[model samples]
Target: MIQLKAGQNIPLTGDVVRFGAKAEAALDVCALVVAENLTVFSSEDVVFYNQFATAGVVLAADEVTITLAEVRADAKAVLLVVSADPIAFPGGAGLGPVTATLSEGDTVTAEFAATPTAGETALICLEVYRRGAGWKLRAVGQGYVGGLAVLLAAHGVDVDDEPAQSDPPPRPAARSGQGVPAMTGPVSGEASTVAGAPLEVGHGVERLWMVFEDAARSAAALVSAREYAAERLDHELSLAVSDPATRNTPAAEEARRVAQQRNDELIATAEHRHQQDTEQLMRELADADQALPPALASWDSPAWDKPAVSSDGIRLGELYAIDRGPLRIPYCVPVPLNRPLWIDTESTRAVAPVVGALLARLLAAAPQRQALVDIIDLTGAFSGFTGLLAPVLNGPLITDHADISARLQAMVDAAELAELAHTSGAFPAPTEHRVLLAADFPHGYQTADAQRIGALIMRGDVIGLSTVIVGTNESDSADTTVATLSQSCRHLPTDGGTTLFDPWTGSAWQLDLDLLPQEPERQARFMRTR
Candidate 1:
């Protein structure tokens, strides 16, 4: 073991190294980066997700955090080699032991193992990524592109050079004495582009780079996986390795051998993480096994239990349907507000005759019927439905007439429950019948034509309908008749500016008299008439 102080950033030379407790500047042993919010972790080695802790650190270094969830280095010397930096090389290929949520200059210093004297700059291309599982590594390339795409797409990064297709900096050669090769003296395409201009980098060039990345990853993975499979297949187990007493006996030797084998296996697993890609290895292992795990097998297999789709009924949400309830309900005639219907007070009274027909309808909210029927009275031109009130945009905006009508109907239906509370002749129990007041409703919700309202009044349930009157000065014969009817019935103003006059007992006062408060003008007229 390399002898350094209790807390240091120096690289340990030997593979066999250990850390003590938190007090001794030793953190817990774990492969994943952990912090409160992101305890499990999204990406490891270098912390991501604006949370989670990085591995291998001194107490003071680890303790210093900017956010509640992450740690930061105080000294600028320690740094992470991210994908964006110009100085990336043998370093930034993967996450380092330390990470920060937002980008910052490195605070602490780091000492990497001595660089090998070998080949061209060591490459660290995008590998496998996390989609289904947490972060999983892709096997070195020349393999499955679709699988890799699935993994990396979520991170907003992809294994393919597709990302590089946008602008990327010139490739930095493995750090030489000449400060990370600058693109210019190096005349790099990514470095020399004019602002906002098309990035001078070409796809042909990126494809060439992919060729290298794909081959290298694939080759490295193949070698590592084959070796691991061979070693694991041999199958050995042991307990002790170096005890003298054990060395003497075959059983002892076997135990020592097994111990050595396990150690080798552990090393192999670690190597699989660093050298070959973990994803490729797992895929290879599964391939060797030939069948999926029971869970995945059942999952991937076709499901016959789900019901089949049908094209039979009215389409809703989508273009498909399945048999729902036992009631074989026939379609209702839809009064789609395809065109503009006048919506003034007068138009209201004119249409009242039609609405009167609906009075007998088994309004689900009938007990609260007065409120529902009156809600129509409550309606003033809502600005939200203004453009929508037009034939084109009408009923499609925030306050669709559909909703308006439905709410009015709902209020009436809800009143039904209240009506159940009282059996007074004033509020009759709605019968099982549904009423249609479309008589003379001319094509759509058009202006309240005298002929139209007249026809609906004669044929429809006049008592139940609502008659809307426009123009404060004078109303039509219908309005005059309704206003006169108000003499006998109970009239209550809905929350909206209008009031309802219901017909009741006496023909002399056919409209309910409760609405006396509703009309100051009529109250004045009564004095004049008297």
Candidate 2:
């Protein structure tokens, strides 16, 4: 299940969902059907203890159920709300901490916690709203000091002046003209949301990550719909043949045919919807790529035509599906990277281009003289990038084993000093972003060198340093320290294997590795700008 923090949101999976509330004391649960203006047109749209069901919303003893497929066409959102018992505690006591759960049948899909302040009597726990072709659930956690009457009046619901225990926090109020505050704004030129997660407006790297997340969600939804269709078809067919009286009969045959046709139609509809979603995301991706500040854009992106500026991330590659036609999303990771990057493969020639592209992107992400590089090639594996990076290197490229040891020791010391200064505030903290490009690792290194390398890999981000080590993990002994450190790094295969799992959904995505141009002039042109 996805645990949602306050102000976070995620895409819903199925049409029929249950929103349940659990608290120390019994709280009143309800749902309000609202329009795009976030106001209820009529009082009948409110589904609560008194009006138990309306517009596909059902409020039970402990939960509120919503059927997305049956919701009214004019409704834009369903607000899941929980209020404290005013009758039980008339002094406006808080609801303490309430946990809200969203489930599809028996499986819990997502959850959020709503903690009301001392005087707040009602809380808007979740918002199940229409987002594009699908729906999404956002953790609102918006509370009110004035009770359920204020909540209803805020959404334009007229209150009755009758005393009723069934009404949630019973109180009368005149209808209000105000609406709930909008929780989203624009990013770039479009709405600032990705897979229902709201984003900071105008940040290109965040936008890039958001687009990638959206594609992952879209892809996952397609797979789920297809599987559900197939399962439904199978279940219907089984029912048709289960009874011996109907087995092999004309009626059974007709049932099977109808079931198959419906299944095919569902699959087709799902595919069409998925295509629409993908196309929309692709357009957004293109817009985000064009706005990227040269650091997060692809090699051919228009952003590269402009001057390089400091960025918070580095674009490693593009993710695409081999079977899903032409949809491709840019994949990037933040820098001061959290994990060391391991360009893993056996072929020396295959890794050079990837390393070159990465170094170029990293250099472009930082301002002039702020990003430093140290290249160590024991077997001349990464000689191809030397000329391009010669002007910015910390020193001459070290090809000897002893020099590799000395370089690793120096980086370790730098990391230790920087980390110490950050905590102790006794010395001037290092401001430069150091990057180490070590190729042909574990070939000529001793145990002490490997240990030093391990320390650097583990604490690189904390010290404003990054490591892009090229080597194969397949042949390393699993029990060794080098193997342990290698496993800690983010492995990007240099061979033909391109599948990488997304952090949000763990969905496998095919990464199209960014390769630098082979022309010397083109490579030099990129370096000249830095």
Candidate 3:
């Protein structure tokens, strides 16, 4: 076995180069094949056997092998990367160093050093490049604060810009052929100079160690389980043992262990409490589901006898009733232009279809195209209606929180324009009457966002703008329409019908809301024109 230090270059003697890390650590090995001009052909050129396509690299359980024959003839070199799972950092924040050595049958193995700290997540281990007509290997032990995604992003790979989730990327399948066993031992974090001399302690070295320590503590706090904490402690102590500050100080080791243990215990306790709360919520949903009536046969069922559309705007669905009486008068609920409508459901599944149908009806019934429609769907619950409302939609479907805020600011500007138009008696209103459909409330919104939405709901009527906010939970703002789905169809109140509690009058009304007709022809026609 050959011991390779960082910056040490060696000539390659084989066509098959294998990059492998210990299986116990669950590290992801990636090979970045770059052209001599330093430009990547495509995202696939950086291969790591995940959702992204691998170009010239072949994946195996313990290592990723690069076949020089399959590589583009014009390619300059390959940068081998070993990345820790950003979510868990299985062995710690950093990936141990990787060594390249020639094995029997002309196969080369790149073995990683054991991780030094629990905090190092991303590392650029080594580079194999073309030197004139021969290939050479150079050990470059560079550490990064984030995971594989960050490393890939640095190299110009366009990854999803959303917040990282807890799930780790899929692991590679086991290799079919066996070549050689990796060298076993802890690898050094420090890299050697190109002159084959030990690197002197410098500001860069001190800063890198500080970054590792900070990442270690942060990773320890992120996980809420005993096993994760213990794993972090093991990796941390391994580095601590080699450090000058904690190597001889037995008391420091004991203190760190005690603190880590306490943190684990606290995390476990919090998780238990959260589990109990979730169980209680589940029980409530189950009871509500049971109390709901049988599902309706269709949207056009005669059982929904009450007229949803009359002289007054749109009506909610029919009411729930225990007994039928001839003298009982059917109530028609109106969603007026100036007033905001709030619909709350007990079901976990989204009810955006129902909201979309109502908006379509209102927009279709508008006078001389005086009204326009805008939908702010943070949860993507209303994506199905994108085709139907494409013509009248104010902007693209909003999925980002920042975009929602910007939309609201634009609405505020429109409101100011509407006020001027109303005062000056302009021939046409500065802002057309708009019906904003907001679904899945409070899920992605911050406290400030909720307040801004509430203000819009309060003053919408005078500005000829109306909002229909739909959510799973109840809210105190605006008049509310309480509903529950039975057999995947909307069911309104029966006895008096669904209850509509008016915040303005402080009075409750029992009315059967009308179900709008699902006209496919009308929808297609509207989609084609204004």
RMSD of 3: 26.2
Stretches of candidate 1 exceeding 4 Å from the true structure: 1-202, 210-241, 263-530
Ten contiguous residues with the weakest lDDT in model 2:
180-189
After superposition of all CA atoms, the RMSD between model 2 and the true structure is 14.1
Across 26-50, the per-residue lDDT of candidate 3 in tens digits comes to 6677778765333355777887767
lDDT per residue for candidate 1 within 461-508, as digits (tens), equals 312332332222122224554333222221122123232111110001
Query: Which candidate number maximizes lDDT?
Result: 2
lDDT (C-alpha) at residue 103 in model 2: 94
What TM-score does candidate 1 reach? 0.18
Q: Rate residue 489 of model 3 by lDDT.
A: 16
lDDT of 2 by residue, 455-480 (tens): 88766755667788787763356548
After TM-score superposition, the amount by which residue 172's alpha carbon in candidate 1 deviates from its true location, in angstroms, is: 10
Q: Between prediction 1 and prediction 3, which has the larger TM-score?
A: 3
